[model samples]
Target: MHPIPRIGPTEAADRPRWSVIVPVHDCAPFLADALTGVLEQLAEDDCEVVVLDDDSTDDPARVVEQVGRDRVRFVVNPGRLGASATFNRGLELARGDLVHLLHGDDMVLPGFYSTMAAALDSTAALAAICRVEDVDIDSAPLYRTRSYRRGTGVWTDALDALAVSNRVRAPGIVVRRSGYELVGGFRTDLPHAADWDMWTRLAAHGRVAFVDEVLARYRRHPGSDTRARVLTGANVRERVAAIGVLAGYLEPRRRPWVTRRALVYATVFAARTSLSLARSGERRAAGVQLAEAARCLVQVPGGPPRISR
Candidate 1:
């Protein structure tokens, strides 16, 4: 199989400069909110919305029909294409200069469009990202990520920062279609952490504009992919692998410190999450997390942080 999800060359039409692609998989309950957020802000002539399903059991098509039937296009994969391919299909189908892969369960806040558009336009950035808030299933805000900058500006340290951390989530980010084409598609191998890998690729290629204000809400629930991976410790394991994939993108001298720093963060995070899960009586999941922590520790420089059983 190819190392990355392939997005072939295609003719570019000169209309609808914005494409809001919502990739769904059994996220019927929250699909409406996502469609609504984009529809409310879009200039109909300049934007198109596509809801692509990864062959989910849930009839999300029905939900899409009720949400914005007139304005949205819906497509379903013949079989599950996983996150990377599902997203690559969105990019392929997009006839827009800017593409936003707003996950079905996520929603953009008011002014999300105007602010992000202006940021990219003024800065000529390859991509633009804003602070994202984590929310519950009910759409109640839990917490927001730290500001990447004091205000809206171009990020100079994006590549370096992304190598050691993945603070930016998909909903809060928009990529220029041209830059994405140059960078290639998401890595199919890193199923759970492919977005992080793609972000590192983007940062490596060009500038990333940042908006300090929180402009998107990322739903964190049991049904979400990250949460599902957490149960089996696949999230941490994939992240460790993703972090390792980033080494090739950095300077030779910087690679060692970046890899070590990222591995330490992953190991500590897994170990701490394991203890928390264990205290909450999730023994099976906790054990899985602890094992992953051990695996990460093997690659981390220096000794592991102290952790109690």
Candidate 2:
């Protein structure tokens, strides 16, 4: 990757503080609300919203115009670049010191930018994240996520936090542009866990600050990639692949521990996916998942018990 040109304080001051990149794909129904939420929090010329339409069949550009023609700059991709590539395009076009990539279906709360930006600024961390609440298709609150709420402070040991679980939500994360310049964009290869992978990489560079309050709403619907992938048993595979990739980034001595943890996590996750598939009336797929889980257990470094699923 080529080095990004260093910008002086004067040049940065001339640009927006926040470059909110909203990537939309067939999310016309939710675009208006998402844009509204972000537009309301924007501070005059200090923030710019870049709404990129990833060749959505539902004409997301119409929704963007209806919501805020003056507030947002809508760009329609000539061809579908998928999520990671589209987001990387936004990163290239971003002119702000801080970047926030918000999914079109997810809406930020009233004080999300203010709170998260403050956290990053005060802590001088590379990235800041707030607690995210899961919402139904209708945008009604389901439950608040406590993944990043271990405590409200700057976490310098981000690897430790992420090793347990992906505590940061994509919508809730606000990262410095310098971090992206250093770590590069999200991996197009890890579709399901690209965001998790990016966060882990950024964490390796600097601290990640967390806020205690819920600042964003993550819409959980059947159409979402995570839910759809999980239903098809692809989520398990992608998750394991992500764990393997992240394990490679660990220190030599720490790699062994992370590798074992990855296997254990993958095994447990496969079992859970199996149960979910069975509950969803996919008995055959569930059986396949169980077999995979058993295979994962058998593949552990040392031979253990011959556990049958």
Candidate 3:
């Protein structure tokens, strides 16, 4: 392993470029490729890659060390600090003008940094986001791309769209350091939905630029965080919370549409949870989920009673 660069706070500020922060936890198998994707674009003088290993039980630290520490700064957490805490920590440690929160399982496509940096330079927005391609565990395409390009970049409508659906995947966003600090980074309370909450708050205060090209790859696996959120039904609660948050930002007429979508998503999530639990022979859990679904249905007047398959 090469010698790790002794990066001081001043040294990072002097670079005045992008800093890629990746929070790794039990993802040693994919960390190599993720780091490679980031380091390859750095141009030596432009950016630095920081990997915060949150007490990963896997051999991620060893691999990072073997890959050389000159371009990458590998920090090992004393204990497992969950994703939200890890991301916040990375933000605190980042020494760049801009921060890109790349997950350990995701990768940056070729020319990603240059393209986004140029976009940021041209615009006066606090952050810029690009379209993201969804890939399976084996890196195969998942048939649909996710993005946030509607509504002519209006903040209020963007907030509503985000509250209704998580079109802004975390990996696709590159936020300015000052803007990230202003929004207080990710919320530590909501472990599973902090990213959703953060983005909602981000759009409320500043302009967000959207690049239609797919510059990042978001990897989805059965054991991935997204999958866990879906299977455990945490996504429903997250979306509901997002709706409540957006109420403070959206117009009255738009509020109804946001509420309607929340209820619809909640109902569908409950049904999915019930069915999954039933298939696993957890009848009692399934019943509980069904009751929750019934409660959500009652909240919306004139709402459809049936949950779509």
Name model 2 segments beyond 4 Å from true. 1-13, 147-150, 303-309
Q: How many angstroms is residue 275 displaced in model 3 relative to the true structure, after the best TM-score fit? A: 7.5
Report RMSD (Å) for each prediction in the order shown. 2.6, 3.6, 6.4
Candidate 3 residue runs with Cα over 4 Å from true position:
1-13, 147-156, 225-232, 251-256, 268-293, 301-309
- Model 2: weakest 10-residue lDDT segment is 1-10
Range of the 10 consecutive residues with the lowest summed lDDT in candidate 3: 1-10
Clash totals in order? 0, 0, 0
Who is ahead in lDDT, 2 or 3? 2
Better of 1 and 2 by TM-score: 1
**TM-score head-to-head 1 vs 3, winner:** 1
State model 1's lDDT: 0.88
Q: Is candidate 1 or candidate 3 better by lDDT?
A: 1
- Collision pairs in model 3: none
| lDDT, model 1, position 230 | 80
Query: What are the TM-scores, per candidate, against the unseen true structure?
Result: 0.93, 0.89, 0.82
For residues 1-309, what per-residue lDDT tens digits would candidate 3 score against the true structure? Answer: 111122223354375587888898888888888888887778767787888989887887776887646778888887988887788889888888888999888888998888787777777677777888888878998855544555223233566666666667778888888777676767666667678777776777777777778888988778766656554556566666656665665677777777777787777778888899899898876876777777676666466655589
Q: What tens-digit string does per-residue lDDT give for candidate 2 at 1-309?
A: 222232222255578898999998888899888999988888768988999989999978778778886788999888998997788888877889899999999999998988888888788998988889989998888988775446668876677557535777679899898888877887877766778888888787788898888889998886666766655667766766777677656777887666666677678888988998899898987887787787777655555445599
Best by TM-score: 1
lDDT for each candidate structure: 0.88, 0.79, 0.74
Q: What is the TM-score (0 to 1) of candidate 2?
A: 0.89
Arrange candidates, best TM-score first: 1, 2, 3
